[model samples]
Target chain A: MFLIKHEVQVLDAKLDKLHHDIMTHQENILILTAEWSYLNQPGRIESLARRHSDYRPTETKQIINIENLPYPKKTSLVRGRIDGD
Target chain B: MVIKFDGLKSQKSIQLDGSVNKAIEGGRNRLLVLSCVFCLAFVAAGVRLLDVSVLRGLQEPIDVVEPTKENLKIGRAEILDRNGILLATSLSVSSLYADPQEVMDINSTVEDLSTVLVNLEKEKLFKKLNQKKRFVWIKRGITPMQQAQINALGLPGLHFQKEDRRFYPQRNLSAHVVGFSGVDAAGLAGVEKQFDGRLRDGSEPMTLSIDIRIQHILREEIKKQIINFNAIGGAGVFIDVDTGEILGMVSLPDFDPNVLNSASADTKFNRATLGVYEMGSTFKIFNTALALEAGTATMESGYDATRPIRIARFTINDFHPQKRWLSVPEIFQYSSNIGSAKMALDFGPKAQKKFMKKLGFLDRLPVELPEKGKPMYPAPWKKISTITISYGHGIAISPLHLVSGVASVINGGIRWPVTILKKNSQSKMFGEQILSLQTSKDIRKMLRLVVENGTGKNAAAAGYMVGGKTGTADKQSPTGSYAKSSRLSSFVGAFPIHKPKYAVLVMVDEPKGNKKSFGYATGGWVAAPAVRQIIKRSAPLLGLLPVDEVSPQIRRLLEIKTPQQKRGNQLASF
Candidate 1:
């Protein structure tokens, strides 16, 4: 009986620790998500890229052909052999 | 016997009478009664003690029925653009406060708090701690690291109050649309107020039809025009013509909703939805559509516009008069005021009212924004009103109304009400039919011709088949006179015109001409180029391919016929 009560108390303590960890993790996720979105705002990214690199806005010519979309027209391979081949 | 004898001896010595012995006996009986009462009380106490101590059973634990509260927050749900970019989000933050009475050592407590919250001044903390009040706010919106440090200090009096604060990740990029919330997480304006109940439920995030990429392009173009032309203000909106889903809407002098308290009333005004103007020649689009739908005019019909008409102290004259007869298509292409007025008079006022009513010009715009303008039209509906209204005067409608009206006319005559929520492209569309399919096709041709050869050439954008109309109205003075110096110049159009998919509008208020424009502030010079720039940049992003104008299918689709009869023949070139 004593052993059973001790086991129950230990399990209760473990459950409380797990619940506390979950709550802490959820709060952390919320804060991190808000920060992630703030950092990923388009204007900030665009300005940073412009300052660091020579990038221009996309034009019609830059977009690939619609027919070849979802997969490019060609994939090349060197004429080398694998053991199975 | 010995006690009684002693009492008797004491009584005999004091009184020497039988009465003394009787008195002694009475006293003894009284003492005995008091002792019996005391003994009964003691016996009752002893029995209760034994009953409680020996008969009571083992103790049992009370059950806790309350569910965990960490997942249950009363915060507003997130708002995202159509592509899932977070526009507005609710974040849980910690607010530090102190109980002055609970502080064991005020100096030490203040010192400990200042270590974690570096920005807090020591003097202010001392003043707050010295106050007789029970509670005071130390700081609000503390970061997690600061919270952890404060917790590590294990201060007795300090506490953290958990609160939810709204954060606009996009900042001012989509301010006028996704509005701000107050400190208590109550929505205040725009879409926030429009869907307050759903947002307050906070079950899931809501998505708006606004595409941030297109919104950025549209705002940038309008901003550029406002700066380059030195305009007082500008407004622009672009929509999916078929679905009536607003892809992007921008009203310049917009506010940063994040810092909403700093935004003034002028900057917060959503001009695109609320500001109404007498939309000069653009109303001619409707007049032409009305004439064709009512059988009052045809493709080959001719109107004699050799001279301006003068009636009721008003002269109806074209801006660039040809002073000769023009075909139905010519009146539309040249945007002749005399020709449009004549065409309007043929159908009369009653028919025009019915037509306008069907096109939603008679009511407030049915958009989701609370800021809306009711159109101003002449209540009496006179012949003069009809004539002026035909050429886009004597009636004031919002820019949103004109854009959606153009959309309905171009989208095979289906009048879909403008919406800010995304309409599933695969869902079957049901809308009111305001015009015949034939009239719609004919108007599409006229719009394309305007871009190709007429006043809207600047609107040829990401596609060759862009179709549009331009409007330049003299702003009315307070004393009911036209002010020539101030004009409302605007351009509205659709791209991929043959199978029209998108409609856009750019309006510039009181733009002063610059060296680049050669001192002209008309729509052709001011607002049309902005439309072209916007559509050209945004079209590739929107997945609209550049149409090949010379292709046989394209040529056949946009080909216009010249009236063969001598009466309808074109004027000879110089």
Candidate 2:
């Protein structure tokens, strides 16, 4: 009886600590998500890309379906290794 | 037992008398009674102790439910985009308040707060702290860094209360959709107001259907056109035609929800869903579709456009009049007001009224926002009302009404209720089929032809098959007369029009003519190009695969043939 009561006491204390940790982690995650959204605002990123990088808005003409890519030419077949097939 | 009684000392000691015997008996009985009472109390106490420990333990279980989130009452809930980008969130921040009566050395405390906080009115603070009152707020929302500095000061009477401060990290990006909340963390506007109970009670974050990236693109494109044309203001919305999800919606002259008080009423007004306006010739899309669906008109049906129709001191003229007989497809292609009005007459007012009501045009927009506008139309269904409403006059509806209504027409004629929340992928959606499949297909072809060879040619984005209608309405002045000098130019379109996935609508209020547009402040000149830019840039991000424009399959879906074309009549190939 003494042993069981002592074990419950220890487990209750540990459960409380875990709860506190979970709360702290949730707060931290929220703060981090807020910062990420703030930094990645569309207008700010667009201006930054324009000034420091080669990225441009994708044009409609640039987009194509995956199936539209031509299949590999028959003449361009590689010289065979035993396992290359 | 050494029993000796006081009766032995009595006068009856001379001989053993009956009195002595009686006194002895009485004393013995009293001693026995006292002993019995003491024993009963001890026995009762023992039983009670046993019952509390052993019996109760078997009957009831110990409660060990671990309370996690309930321990801390810090914030309400968060709002995120469909992609899980946070749009609105609340953080637990310390609000500084002071008990004026407890404030020791007010001058020093004021000096300490003034330095730590920017834009702090020192005089106001000093006056407030000098009062005999118990509590007063120094500042409601303060940064954690400033809070740390105040804590370092270690001033007496200055206390902090933990409260959640609502933050719009996206700023003005989704102002009208996500809306704003009050200082008490209660929602006041937009999605915040719509789902206030869920946001307040539940801990899980709410996800909106709005894609924030597409929202930014739509806003930027609309703002550019509003500035370029020097228009008063504008609103735009894009709906997923298949799913009835609003992908991106923008209203210019929009306010940043962060600074609610500074924005004017005009800027705070959400023009997209809350402001109803005459949508001009865009209603012809409905007129033509209804005519086909009612079997009053066919694809090769003809209407005379030789001259303007005059009725009851009102003359309906086409903007680009052909002055010749036009087929049903040609009437839509040219946006003929006379022909559309004529078609509406043939169909009559009863079907038109029912169709409009079925399309949700007779009621307030059934959106989640509190700022929704009620559509305006003539209460008494008259012939003139039907005629004018055919060309989108004598009626007013919000831009969202047009977008969603057009969506139903194009997406196989089903009227799905629009929603702002991101739907779970597995949820089945069902809506009433309002028009026939053949009518929907025919309307799609006419819409494509408008962009291909008619007034909406400017709306064509490369590789993505575009289909649309252009609208230019005369702005009504305060005196209830049309102002010819001012115009409302708008364009509404769907992309990969053969099988549309999205519908984009843009409307510019009172745009002025510019040199590039050949001094024409029309829908083609002002609004169509903006829709073009939005559809082009956002298509790739939306996972739309562009197809070959001249492919045989694509041409077959959008091709139109008229009676004049079949007969090779002497007419312009429009």
Candidate 3:
């Protein structure tokens, strides 16, 4: 009984440490995503591109349509359009 | 008895000694076990406490995580000209907060903070320190320098929160159309208010009908004239003739959204979209078009413009006072009020109202601007109103409404709602037909004649085939009567009359005439020249090709017989 209880306590400590490590990793990932979006905004990208590149970037006016997209090979898992009537 | 005592004593002594040693051994063993258990428990408790209080923050943890706040912004979407220039944007700034619990050296801290934060009261900051709150806001949107100084004080508990603030970078440049964002980022006026939903929440930037470069030209030239003539206010607009887009719009006395609280009401008012004025002879284009479209008049049509026509309580007279019969083209070139009134009489009020309604002049304009005015029209639809409105005196409409209407007149007679969002050219073009293509062509001819030989002669740019109308309406006093002296001068013109591409409108209110203008504050004298300057500067930037001044096609399309009165005279000089 003593040995079992000792093992359970050890497991609990290990679980707690894992939780902290996972939480810290998640926080870092979220911060990175926010930074990525900020840097990717067109105004900032255009400024950087103009500074470094000889060619001016062209403005895009296309709106992606679902029907025009390619179908996935795993057809069995695919369902009806996510955005549709 | 002595033998019995010796025997008992010996046995007792041996038994007692043996038992005492055995009991001591057992007691020691139990004490050893208990000591080991207690030590283990103490170490476990200490480790758990450390993990909770220091590592895992299960106890006494600092609440460093920022709470997710609700977005409380209500302001309109910003309008940007085509080039991604910041016609409008939101700025994020640091707002100061206080943590009373952390504050030490309160009096000194307050004194130091006051030196950096100019608007803050030292006494108030000191009073805040006396409060029991864990946190309180010291000020919203403190300058970075102020924040740095506050930080230098090392006052333990001072904190800051970031706030998003709306700003118009191109301040007052396209004031009327771009509008201004409100304190909470809600669209209170112009495009900001009009497309608030798209601007407030959408991921993409909103593109407006404005061209920043053209907008700058219009504003600079208009400002020059306003300063030169000492005008009360000036407004200008540019439109794409083909797309029905407003390229540039400006209203002087514009406010900077950055210092909104300090700006006066006059600065906030948008004259181009909100303030409706009697556009005077600018409306003659509509009248002439309506007459030709309804078959009530033709290019060969003549009106007796020899004398001023007396009506019930009004007498219609031309500013130049031509005392002879006028052809349709001559009437427009000369801007004959009598002739316009006669043409309106033939067309009748019902037709005029219908045509104006179809031209989108009756209701509030369908532009992506929130501050547009609902046009003021007479309820009774009286004949006098018709005659006066024909010459642009009785009805009042916003300059934006006029721009859209004129675009329809020239853009193959189609009315497309002006927009601020950049659009894909391939998107199916949608517009309502407002006039016959033939009528639109004929109006173009007459408009070209005005610039070539009419009141709009001053509006001509050397190579750009400019066609426009000049208007000088008598300003009405607050007492509901027209003032004899004050005038509201305006000019609306389009370029490359054979194939119109852009329209420009400039209006100046209460202009004090100067010597260069010969003490004249009429539209031709004040506003037309501003239009000319804007075109001269914006033409190259727009990439419009400079044409031969006397292009054969332009000359043939804009032919006008020199009137009999001026036939022998040197080409009537401006």
Candidate 4:
């Protein structure tokens, strides 16, 4: 039983390390997303697109706040339940 | 006989049975054909199973779980000054949390943690462990050293959640303009609150008009003077003459945004932008500007400054009383209250109000800062109020308000919004033509005279054409009376009058008379020298060339009329 308990402890350590690695990867994704948005700023993107890509810049108005933002079509489906229920 | 016959019949019957058996055999052959067909079908089914399982093994396997970990919310954008200085930013900090299921000895871990983090509550830590939660926070935003020490304890279930803490790198250097953030990282005051949404967009750094270098110089000068004088408080502002940009603004008794909890209300008070006082003789510049703009006075126009004018139980007299005739230039040079009152009388009440309104003194200042205070003008607009305001006593306005108006007076009469940020080339110039170009020129000529011959002689920085006005007023006590002993002394001046670049102002509140001031803490003695020191230090930084004393620009700007020089009479160098 003592040996079994020791094995369980090692397994737990491995599980914890795995969880930490996953979280670290998740954080890296967030940082990449932030950097992507930073690069995609209207001015920066336009300059880049003009130099290296076929995409064109479009005029955008400042959305004053989050509450006043327009809703997306697929947003309601996020909870995994359908409207029929 | 019947048996024998039966035997004979039996043979025939046996023959018949054989024929029946043959027929039965034929049926059996048909059944055997059906059995063969059934075996063929079973063989085909086995071949189909082999084809599906073995031959199709190269095809991709169907997935059991879907991958959906791409979308997450982003944090707010950073705010930086024009030169890429970090005015506001976020730092990643680790917060301690725990999972009770993995904990070996909760009591020992809690005890060790509480010792490291002295502020941690013992009961709370014990309760969190006993509550049977999988995870709970022990502390938020512990320093890295604390985290390392806690980790060294090898406590089970101890974990950390990485968080972003907003940091102001410049600290209280420009607190009033940069403002501060709340615990949730929301802007609570100043520019942070005004541009809150823009900051959250995360597109680019929000650049402000403030220059950290200029801000440092202005704050240092104000702090030095405030300390030296041992006064209650003071404020200083440096404004661009042509563009109306506020290069620097400093209010004494400012607090660091990082240590905001220990700050008092007075420390948080933004005196330069929010505190409005009856700016004494600084308004004389405006009064003279109005007189010149209204064509009410010429440089040579004479006003009697010999006696005090008693109007309705209030006497208007110059602090340095000159019981003699004075010209318009002389009136301004000596900062004579009687002569200024006469000039205001010449402009009259209607014209004076109209001119001040044109300067944007009657409303809130137009700077980008949100901590602006409205001017306290008289409600009834009486003649006495106009006359008293002429010498700067009745109407109260902020130091920023005075700086903007003074910049207009020197920058050929264009009152633009004072800016902290450097203006990009695309921004169009904004202001109104309050004074004619000729009137601006004439005022500049006279302001230079104040530095040369008048009470502002102490405000001279050698080789720089410095011109300004001195103002001293009694501070009103709480019981509806003016305190005789307390005074607010202020000086406002600009350099190289021919081509003005900056306007600097220094104001001291309730300064006591020290031995150095010879029992007199008036603007001329106390505030003028502060302005002189500021110019001596700030001029070279602004890249202003201190021309030769005999340079035509200096000669024309600072020429004051004087009687033939006596043998002992020596001219001041600034």
Candidates 1 and 3, the one with greater DockQ: 1
Arrange candidates, best DockQ first: 2, 1, 3, 4
- Pick by lDDT: which candidate is best? 2
Interface RMSD of each: 2.4, 1.8, 11.9, 15.4
After superposition, candidate 1 runs with Cα above 4 Å error: A1-8, A61-85, B1-74, B96-160, B425-429, B462-464, B563-574
Tens-digit per-residue lDDT, B1-574, candidate 4: 3457668888767977889789889999999999999999999997887776667746854642332332222355666665656677655668898888888887888888887888888888888887777988778777789989888887888999877766666777768887877766788777777777777665466777666666776777667666767788988888888888777788888888766789889988889989999888878888988887787887667789999999997888877676887777767766789999998998799998888898888999877667889899987888898889998988889998898899998888887877766688998887887888877877787777677666678888876678787788887677857786887888898887767788888888887777777767777777788888778766766666566656665676545444421311232211
Q: Please provide the root mean square deviation of candidate 3 (C-alpha atoms, Å).
A: 13.9
**Ten residues in a row with the worst lDDT in model 4 chain B?**
B565-574
- Rank candidates, lDDT, best first: 2, 1, 3, 4
- lDDT per residue, candidate 1, B436-505, as tens digits? 9999999998898777777787787744478999888989999999988999889998988899999999
lDDT values, one for every candidate: 0.84, 0.88, 0.77, 0.76
Q: What is the DockQ of each candidate?
A: 0.37, 0.61, 0.02, 0.01
Residue B225, candidate 1: alpha-carbon lDDT: 86
Where model 2 places Cα greater than 4 Å from the true spot, the runs are: A1-15, A76-85, B1-61, B68-74, B425-428, B563-574
Docking class of 4: incorrect
- For residues B168-201, write the lDDT of model 3, one tens digit per residue: 6555565667666665667777777777787887
Q: For residues B1-574, what per-residue lDDT tens digits would candidate 2 score against the true structure? A: 3435875465446543677677878888887887788788878887886887687868755676656565653577889998998999988778999999888898888887788997899999988987878999999988889999999999989899988888888989999999899999899989999989999987788988999989998999989999999999999998898888898988988998988979888888899999999999889999999999999999988999999999998898988778999899988888999999999999999999999999999898777788899999998989999999999998999999999999999999998888788889786787879998888999999998888778888898987888999999998899989998788899999988999899999999999988878788899878999988988988889888788888998888877777565432222221
The list of candidate 4 runs beyond 4 A from truth reads A1-85, B1-74, B97-110, B118-139, B154-159, B557-574
Top-DockQ candidate index: 2
Instruction: Estimate the overall C-alpha local distance difference test score of candidate 3.
Output: 0.77
Q: For model 3 chain B, where is the 10-residue window of minimal lDDT?
A: B66-75
Docking class of 2: medium
